[model samples]
Target: MRLILESKFQSLLLNWYSKNARILPWRSKPSLYKTVVSEFMLQQTQVKTMLPYFERWMRLFPSFEALSEANESNVLTAWAGLGYYARAKCLHECARGFVKNPVNSYRQWLNCKGIGDYTAAAIASIAFDEAVAVVDGNVIRVLCRLLSITESFKTKEVALKIIRPIANQFLSKTNPGKYNEALMELGAIVCTKQKPRCEVCPVKSCCKSYQKDTVHLCPHFFQVKRTCCTMQRYWIRDTHAFLLEPSTVGKVFRNTLQGLLELPIMTPQRMSVVGLGKLIFTGKRSIGPKDFIEQIYSPQKQVNSQSLMSLPEFSNCVRVPFDQRQRLACTGPHKRWISKLLQ
Candidate 1:
């Protein structure tokens, strides 16, 4: 396999990035706060999906001071439909920590809430102009294919050990920020997993996988085991619908449905008011939307507001008027269900 020389690789990658860099809000007028927030939102999320959310967030809370002063409910509401609720929680904490004493270095960011190595390196290089490498999925794919590292990326620690040094070597010493972004952009747009655009790729001559006719097999992937369970949900309404507050103990749906009201669907021993009323709604929500039957239930017996406050789980329940359901914070899945219910 013909190896890509460091100097030649850096020059071509940077030239390619100069012409093909994505015109993103965070990348356009770059700021420390914006970069940090964008990095957090972009984690496990696509750039296209995060664009509108990023614009909304910047408008809502433009700075560390604004974000730190805001409450968790407001934060989660602004971050709703983003899926990863823990990022909202951690970002809130990070804002608070950053406001107390600003972080300019990667090490300082590491100590802060939810900021991992990749984020730290990205923020440090992009915002602060520090000479460091950022290794994300895009970067990993690019490096693995360029050097032909046909190893599983599921084991993160072991994979990083292989890609990190190569990234450091090819990293632009003077323009590390642009270099990193360029690598990610190349991987995202050109070196795609399904069919790479080798003809248009700037570094195609240096890609070992392209030469070996094994680009598809370069970045090895692990098949994830998915377990699907059958859940029966019951709906109760008084003046409004019934939903539970986010809790750590005895909850199956994690932050996916945080700060929203959902049916009291539990595994076994969760404090729920399912059998308190007649079984008004009966339907099944499969793993996918290929076949879905919608059944709306209007409970005959009005839920007593008095009994809701009696239980620990029901204590956080608030009677959100049907008209004001939009004011409440709900996660993605339950939010869609509620939207469908309201419609």
Candidate 2:
């Protein structure tokens, strides 16, 4: 009965997908390069947001050779506003790898930098119509509910064991690209996290959660508490310009050139207006005794040229306090700073 249900499940899903699949730019007979770029861009990012970036990127670097020849800075600059700059760096490295020994196959591209099983399978099946499985977050959610699996979905072992066979069952030899897209689309649109629209779902007829009328309860989830940290920042300014420093931390904005010309950051424990004045006057001879200091709770808001220029001392400093918190949101692990910057 299980085997029979599985056989029928593939047919219903494939048929529904063929009729309802969204017409996307990368899906119009997508090539290996286009598929790879799309897959990379889609990682932990929304499809709507990635659409414009993907289009612009393809225009800038039309081919693998173009990407390989482009400078690292140029690539990073292109990806400036986009968060997670590491992806851009990894992509550049991958392009170089591809140039070293170019291959038309999706498997060959997967061997390059930053390509993992999910990404590789997505590109392989979507671009080349290869019969491969892609087990992403959306796919995982769909599978967990389908099998009525109560175990934690976080474990890699559990995910691989459950998804590999299910993916294999639907991997179409005739139209792998369409089949893969259908599964992803079903997961993204129908089997969503908040409120799954089971009634209209293509796979609802066979879905275990729907059959049991426990669509909301089948996929068990757990939440973790987040920790918050508070820190201070300073935007230092001299006669000519403001001082800025590059971030040395690993997690957020790692290796990014921030605080282009700003102040020396002092923690809450070490911060005082008079103390800062003394440090500037005594510790650094460059800052004259006449240098002025202001208590700024948020550097992002207070460090503009107009604000700094208005101060008495050309060597002006603003102390800003920021509270950084790390937690998981609806999307994923979110790290944000709350301060007077917004107000």
Candidate 3:
């Protein structure tokens, strides 16, 4: 029964994919380099969100050799607004690795830095047709709903043990690449997390959850508590230049080799000297599990660079001219604030 059902599912998925797949840049022309770039950009990002970044990145660093030759600052600048700066750094290192030694298999890709199991499987299966199943979020959700696996995947071990075997079983032997893409596409557009279009789902009849009328409660997982924090940043400016601190210098920005600079955080000592300027920008942003309420203030009186630079808080800060700030690599929010301030 399982084998018969799997065969039916595969046919339905691949047939739907052939006609309804979105026309993405990477999909339009399937190449090893393009697949690598798209997978990296899509790590924690959606297709719509990463489309512009992918296009710009391809224009900036077209090939693996080109990306390998590019500097970290340039890479970070190109990936500035993408949020997860670490992915950019990993892609840079991966490019260099690919340039030196290109490998197509899943195991070989796993040996490369920052290429985890999912990424390795994706690249291997999608680019090389290696018959490996990719059990990403989309796949997991799809399978869980189809099989009515309601186990809480609070740990990686649990998820791998539960979902992986099923994914491999369902993966097509003749064309694993297209089959995997089709399953992911179904999850993305049809069997979505919220309002799933079950009526239009090609494999709706084969889905156990749909048959049982438990599609809404099919895929369940433990919820995580988000940490909320407030951040106060300063936008101190002199006549020609503004004080910006290197992201590498701060603890908050230590998540990655963020080669960008950000607006200085107003420490108590620094705040005592340079009073809070006019309120320039205030917004809330979430990265991973932490939610940040960020506020940027500009001082009313402009202090000289020498005095500001003498403070411990601004010791490593650089004075970037307003005109030249555009060229400098900066955190996403700071970059937008700087551009908006200029306008």
Candidate 4:
């Protein structure tokens, strides 16, 4: 926390970051818009998982004008594989607002729906060079151990109180943007939750947790309890496995599944069975929980395309001919039921 150590601290991190920062598309040529998009997509999504999606999105909607011009259905389509539908909605609305009237201040960014405190700060500091710190999960872990703070960062209150001050003080005045990013990078690579490589850490000497030999115990993460909701989607396909578009009796299905063909879904209802996967495709899902479960059920038989299409559910959805419609697919994780239709 002293002047010399602080100076050394910032220097070590900056030097390391400048040399070793991961080469990402957005980081290569950063702009306000690019930074905003990356930050929004990065929320709840892994860097590797979001990489292709980000590149595709940038190519599709290169500017705020382009995004603002797109319809919600297309926007959602572009955001496929990246769950959390609400983020896409917010980003779309924000784009429209920005195109109408651009904003240059942190307060203005905060006014946008999808832009939260962390996102706003990241954009303001990284894009605009505002001397604010980003307090994401990585930053919290780094700071918690750096200063030997024992508080849980389950809530923003604890983070703001114990971690924010250190992060701000650690900020490099000459390049606060890179400094914030560097700190996050360090935590992600070196000061990890488990097996933290304290020896290689740039600021290990100045880290309270490292000095105390208690880096592992510093940031006590508070786990949020989450209950799984079972989801059921009905796949109504033609004789050739070409899916119906949920036009009539299941028009409601098409709204959520813009890119794919689907019928009425009976999701997250009562699931009588759940089991573990033990077969050829170990990693591939067979429905049910994460790291577990593969309950294979017989694919339901279907009537001729026209007959099923005429039924109540197929009234509104387009019943593209079996030969024309491509192999039917779902948006999220795959299920055995959908595959069985092909077999």
The number of clashing residue pairs in each candidate reads 1, 11, 2, 15
Best model per lDDT: 3
The lDDT, on a scale of 0 to 1, for candidate 4 is 0.67
Ranking by TM-score: 3, 1, 4, 2
Residue 110 alpha-carbon offset, candidate 1, angstroms:
1.1
lDDT digits (tens) for residues 152-183 of candidate 2: 65555566767777777756667777777888
Task: Candidate 2: list runs displaced more than 4 Å.
Answer: 103-110, 154-158, 236-243, 251-343
Among the numbered candidates, top TM-score falls to 3
lDDT of 1 by residue, 1-343 (tens): 1233777788899998898788999878788889989999988688899899999999999999999999988888888877667788899999998888888987888888778889999988888878889987678888888888887767666677778887887888899888878887897889887788998999988878889987888788676555544444445455554554543211444443445555544422222343344444445443321222334344344566557647665665555566766656665665677666566
True lDDT of residue 313, candidate 4: 47
Clashes of 3: 2
Off by over 4 Å in 1: 1-4, 152-154, 239-241, 247-261, 266-313
Model 4 shows how many backbone clashes? 15
Off by over 4 Å in 3: 155-157, 248-254, 310-312
- Estimate TM-scores for all models: 0.85, 0.71, 0.93, 0.77
